[model samples]
Target: MPKSLTTSEPNVLRPEDFDPPLKRKEPIVPYYWTLDEIATELGVTSRRVGYDITGYPPRKIQPSLKAYKAGSLFLVPDADALAYIQRFRERKKS
Candidate 1:
């Protein structure tokens, strides 16, 4: 048998050597949406998402849950954007 050429110690796995699993505080569902994402999800242009505020009812006619802005980049949380569209439909149907 040939002599071993490597000098590094073996990396044997042990139960006590492992790190604890990560704990998550937030929901698993995708959280935030940019203007482009909102448009893609709703099948419209990014400009439309920016203009319509996630398809919120017109601000003048109804209270609006407007899109958010972060670090000069506009964003809309996924939940809020979907809610805005739902409420828009609800309002229009009535």
Candidate 2:
């Protein structure tokens, strides 16, 4: 039997022996909002988020929202949400 397995040898797994997961060179910063969150923020429903993306002419739902699609999920950055709401007042005034 190997000395490492049979005996408590110094070569046994140590804290320094393991390699950590690879990290990105640059720091990562993510600020995102889900469709459900957007709905709640605007006092609406997730279904309304979809409608806002694609306006419903008959329902008088106009598409005026920005969203980022990562795969099947949609995300709205915090900055964008603020801008969207800020522009809302300007657009209404116009």
Candidate 3:
């Protein structure tokens, strides 16, 4: 038999030799939500949520008049809520 040409060590791997697992992505739900619930998800008070959307296109929902001001029992999309939640998390990390 011919002699082995390679001089490198064998490529055997032990259970402890493995690298740590990668971080998993945050889970996303496929549901719409009301402002109160969205505020909870973003870790903020509901008043702040109201302020965040002020002078912006309102969330799609039936409009009701609260005295002279308008209000919505409408649902905001999960993606929009997630974007706000992401900002909240980043702010907390600093």
Candidate 4:
């Protein structure tokens, strides 16, 4: 048999002898909330949510509240939705 290149025994496998284990990489995807989801959380109908998104009569218009359209579905970022909800609640208190 040819001489072993490593200092360890011919057949022995040691954890320390090998390189460090590779870490699992998680996919980086942004969180989004659908209009129905926001409506469900606020105990309202999706129609009302759409009105809020469009700043119709009765509801105060908020330019900062943004919604993105993907085909027939509209999506809002999690952070923006939470912020908008908080602001809406605060406005109601006034």
Q: Estimate the overall C-alpha local distance difference test score of candidate 1.
A: 0.52
Clashing pairs for predicted structure model 4, backbone only: none
User: Whose lDDT is greatest here?
Assistant: 4
Candidate 1 regions with alpha-carbon error over 4 angstroms: 1-30, 54-65, 87-94
lDDT of 2 by residue, 1-94 (tens): 1245666764332223223311222212356666766565455588877777667899999988778887777777656654554454345569
* lDDT tens per residue, model 1, 1-94: 1235685564433223223311223333356656665555455577655766534455543334566677755766655755655544456569
Q: In model 4, where is the ten-residue run with the lowest total lDDT?
A: 18-27
What residue runs in model 3 are displaced by over 4 Å at the alpha carbon?
Answer: 1-30, 55-71
Give candidate 4 misplaced runs (Cα > 4 Å).
Answer: 1-30, 57-64
Give the number of the best model, judged by TM-score: 4
Which pairs in model 3 have colliding backbones?
none
RMSD of 1: 19.3
**lDDT values for all models:** 0.52, 0.58, 0.47, 0.60
Clashes of each: 0, 0, 0, 0
- Please give the RMSD to the true structure for each candidate, in Å: 19.3, 20.0, 17.1, 19.3
TM-scores of the models, in the given order? 0.43, 0.49, 0.45, 0.53
